[model samples]
Target: MLPNNKIPEHLRSWSVPWPLYMPTFATPPELQPGPGLDASVAAGWAEPAFFPAVNDWPQRQAAALIPFQVVGGRPRNPSGRTGYTGRRLGRWGENQAADPIVTTGAGADRRVLLIRRDDCGQWAIPGGMVDPGETVPAALVRELREETGVDLAGYRAQILTTTYVDDPRNTDESWVVSTVAHYRLPETSPATAGSDALEARWWPFADLDTLLVAVADGGGRLYAAHRRLLGLCGGGR
Candidate 1:
């Protein structure tokens, strides 16, 4: 469901900034070799099966070889620390994306449901990229179902916010992902759906840290979630 050509402007900010698309010898933070580098980094688990693409590029652009990089057995930005150098084509390679932060939790007496990413096996809010053409909300719901098998029929999600997480592989490029978290009665959540999640389950609000996986900005999003929830509880009046 990828969009035809109109790149989503909202997603651009969610990726690595244009100026910081360089190696550590040049960029800041340089993606430290710590918890963020080890588990927080979103691994590209997209194989031909998950992400199907037409093979007409080679023939359509016959003699065109873009300057890019080939890292982690995948093509990347040539100037990227990953050393991906190939012909450049589109202004933004693959732009615009979305994610689903479907959570079920309450306050001191509440619990939050989470899953273990099969690829990384780390607990994370279920999410994925928003396809082209599909509306952000629709994509959010689709991804949520695909990953967890839970239904969001009654949850008309509003934008919680947008975030940009760092990508170590493409120090020259960025992975932009928009997240949509839908709240519901804990009983209706996938953790209770039985046949859904990989290992669908919930945790006490005080136990969120046990997972150790960071959200956008390395735990920044997690804090944001709590703060926003607090405002709602106070009636934000």
Candidate 2:
């Protein structure tokens, strides 16, 4: 557990973000310790067979190398202070996801596929969480098909990067990490929004920098972490 004096003053009094989906058993008062091991053990979400034990620092590091510390038997955020204690995310520790960067055309004509997220109503990469027991590649293909109705089976696919995502939904105990895969198609393919996407379409690669700048300036419609992910693809230069 982190020493009381070591916790930032502001965070020491921070309230947990109460999402409706969180179980009542897991809820706790502001600044109090998170759910206990008995609760997690009963919920079956913290089984060491599937997830790293709360105190298994070495195993957790080996899994994602995120450097999260154990605090009160829960994983503490390594990045810094957050507004919450217990997680709004479904699981404890690293919650893995996959981002599929589907693109068509070349040079100045390049275009990349994007989906309007239903939750935030912002344009983002067509991606979603990797289900338990699923491979990152499989999750990438599945998320692409589910969100944009695009099949990447025959496309030339390459893994671009795997890193921690600074998602807003992150809490002190849980955060997101993702694997980005780039898929290049021969030509523009038919796409329709499905699943959690409100709309899906291709956007000019040349406009990415502008859109990203708009986001930085607080006037853009792109998802924040996605902008960083897109920039890492080595496209739209």
Candidate 3:
């Protein structure tokens, strides 16, 4: 579901300006298109996948609309091209991402693991795109390990929520949907920054408000979607 208030800064449209209105441009050479298996052959949990120009979004109560028409046979970003077009996110239209909130300790000592994204330099719960054939839970575990070196394979996670990601890269054609899950880390879990992260660290739940962020001219920080997700998980500043 869309946020009831203003879109969060990180997910707000950052597409470059176009005359009259912004339009999403093609993916740059450096960025590969979003990853996925062919829709024609998708099996099991991947059966319902939406492929570019291959499958139309199903008519159902659960499906969300993109609010724009297709361009070049691809979904068009309703808002326009984000500054980095396909640089970070590969696909347009319903990009699937997941976040795993790994917490450790308890009471006043409770802390959550966060990673500084290499591209944006902002602290956020570790997350990434879901490859075709992967379930949301599976993707969450894989992404958490890839970014923060935390193993959640044996941990029990609760599905906190699934909602549209207010990612700055969203366009009329491309937007993100994310599934957020939570896991209380074991006492022995050792987290190290890896993969797409610049650093990994644990922040006390009580001190979330004090952490400095790189977004909004440094006056505001924390990935916007994550801030909201954390709220739903009962973590508040």
Best by TM-score: 2
In order of appearance, the predictions have TM-scores of: 0.48, 0.71, 0.68
Judging by lDDT against the true structure, name the best candidate: 2
Question: Model 2 — TM-score against the truth?
Answer: 0.71
Model 1: number of clashes? Answer: 21
If the candidates were sorted by their lDDT against the true structure, best first, what order would they fall in? 2, 3, 1
**Whole-model lDDT, model 3:** 0.64
**lDDT (Cα, 0-100) at 138 in candidate 1:** 78
lDDT of 1 by residue, 69-159 (tens): 3344334432223322221111122333445544444556565545555543345455555554567777767766666667777776756
lDDT per residue, candidate 2, 78-112, as tens digits?
66555455654556777888999998899888899
RMSD of each: 12.4, 8.5, 7.7
Instruction: Provide the clashing-pair count of each candidate structure.
Output: 21, 0, 16
